[model samples]
Target: MFIQSQPADPAIHDKALRIANETLFIIRCLMREEEWGDYLREAYIIARRILEEKP
Candidate 1:
């Protein structure tokens, strides 16, 4: 959804996805399952809001 707002920019899309994945990986490695769940949910909310924002 976030990529859809951009003008066919693969670099931006790739970077955003990379960041999201890296964040998830780090959280998984460093956090307890219960605590990480909340952080993961918050990350998803932030991503969703970014996608929902108007240009």
Candidate 2:
């Protein structure tokens, strides 16, 4: 017999969407600005990876 898969949790989904939306503005800013500090650069990289892997 095969097991069924579960859907994503509503709260978790909402949180993830919110995080993705929030990052868009900053990410766009990062695109225009030439000066990115170490922390911001790291955050941009992580955010890009997350967005790329989305279904």
Candidate 3:
């Protein structure tokens, strides 16, 4: 038998989206740093993707 998945919780989903936005903001600030700029750029892309996705 196939298992069914529960519907997405709005609270949790909102919280996750908020966190992703915050992460993207922080990453954006750090991306300007000379040493870690490259790595932070990649991280920013990932966070941005998470923020853009729907539940």
lDDT of each: 0.61, 0.50, 0.51
What's each prediction's TM-score? 0.50, 0.40, 0.40
Q: Arrange candidates, best lDDT first.
A: 1, 3, 2
Residue pairs clashing, model 3: none
TM-score of candidate 3 against the unseen true structure: 0.40
Q: Which 10-residue span in candidate 3 carries the lowest summed lDDT?
A: 1-10
- What is candidate 2's local distance difference test score? 0.50
RMSD of each: 5.9, 10.6, 9.6
Error of 2 at 34 (Å): 21
**lDDT score for residue 12 of model 1:** 47
User: Which RMSD does model 3 reach against the true structure?
Assistant: 9.6
Residue 16 lDDT, candidate 1, scale 0-100: 48
Candidate 2 deviant stretches above 4 angstroms = 1-6, 30-55
For residues 12-49, write the lDDT of model 1, one tens digit per residue.
44554555666888768777777766775566556555
Prediction 3 global C-alpha lDDT: 0.51
